[model samples]
Target: MDLGKSQRVTRSEIDHILTNRRWSLFDVSVLPSFDTGSDHRLIRASISLNKKNFERDTHRPAPHKIPTFKSADLEPAIESNTWTLFEDLTEDYDHLVGAPLKCADASRHSQPTTIPTLNDRAFAFLEKRKAVKLDPNAKHLEKVITG
Candidate 1:
């Protein structure tokens, strides 16, 4: 972090805690009382029936390769064909529509509605093959999905 710039710098490294063994994670039990003098709680991981459970709390955190925001070079057809939705970006509704409206000016020549109409939704669903909240009797399945 450079103090001259007055900007806080942060970095993250994916430290590999697991070995390349035949065992896989079955269940994780966090031991809160067992203190190792660190902010992190001791996690007792249980593997398959063949393997034994162990606490990797004693082992030093080995830093691995930095996880990259990777992108693959796609074909022209596939690249042009791709389409992303606005709602799926955030789980919260206020952040989705309200945040953008707050930044935008109402004095502009054209002011679009926050919520898209059914016709616009239907068109996108048919043409772009975009996922939509399509229910016959009900409107949104969010409540049902959460329940």
Candidate 2:
């Protein structure tokens, strides 16, 4: 069949059969071409059915029973009171939403701030390290080995 007049065209077709034995195929044919802006042709089929007695419980299985768990088996790692204390420490929802300035305010900056140089970053890192007091006389190797 002449599916289309395009220079580069491809044909696509599908065939299927009904699983039910009662359904019978009577006739099959390729339908007339229509201006659907597509190259694939359509197909039409005629099918007939013969009524048969269908037993409800012939091949069907019984419904499965879902397993139930006891309330004692669902103990969480953290207690409810501890969860409430953690929740209280968190910032308010409204503060979190309103914390950041709008995009328009951020884009309207008159002067751009200069980023810190590598030397400046290194100086800051060294200052922070010097501020942290370490016990020089403590047995660091022995503590790590024991742990």
Candidate 3:
């Protein structure tokens, strides 16, 4: 069919569009041309359902649950005044979130690497990185560090 004509497109069509393919949608005119010579037609399709389903299928994270450790779970050891157990458990949690850089010999590495720690500051830094791009001239870094 002609490029100007409209048709009911599917998720596959939208995908094609996203992948840089041309999409032909039906014209919005109340009356469609009966002449076959014309290259366009008045087509109707529901984007709401397609958009909603696409978002529902692709928007969220993969189905997975992270393990959790509660401080109260260590109450027995704490009651026994076993600080060692507490420290060990704390270290385990740290390792679970991120690998130990010292163990990785970070100083000996040629490339600079950032170890994300489970803390408010680390989270805020990540948020800033996502929201802003780093400038090569260091203008953005200067504003951030000084502010």
Q: Judging by TM-score against the true structure, name the best candidate.
A: 2
Q: What is the C-alpha lDDT profile of model 3 across 1-147, one tens digit per residue?
A: 433346543322111212221232333232254643353443444323355555666676544543333445344433543223235877867654443233333223243244334689877876666555554555766657634
Residue 32, model 2: Cα distance from true site in angstroms? 3.4
Residue ranges of candidate 2 with Cα displaced over 4 Å:
1-23, 35-37, 53-147
Tens digits of lDDT, candidate 1, 1-147: 112234344533222247554456656566563333345555667655432233453355644543232123223323443244556556455455654443332222342434355787677546433223343444355435422
The segments of candidate 1 whose C-alpha lies over 4 angstroms from its true place after superposition are 1-23, 49-147
**Ten-residue region with minimum lDDT total, candidate 3:** 12-21
Clashes of 3: 2
- lDDT of prediction 2: 0.46
Best by lDDT: 2
The deviation in Å at residue 142 for candidate 3 is 3.8
In model 2, which range of ten residues has the least summed lDDT? 77-86
Please report how far candidate 2 places residue 89 from its true position, in Å: 94
Q: Model 1, poorest ten-residue lDDT window?
A: 68-77
**Candidate 2 vs candidate 3, lDDT winner:** 2
Off by over 4 Å in 3: 1-31, 34-37, 50-52, 59-141, 144-147
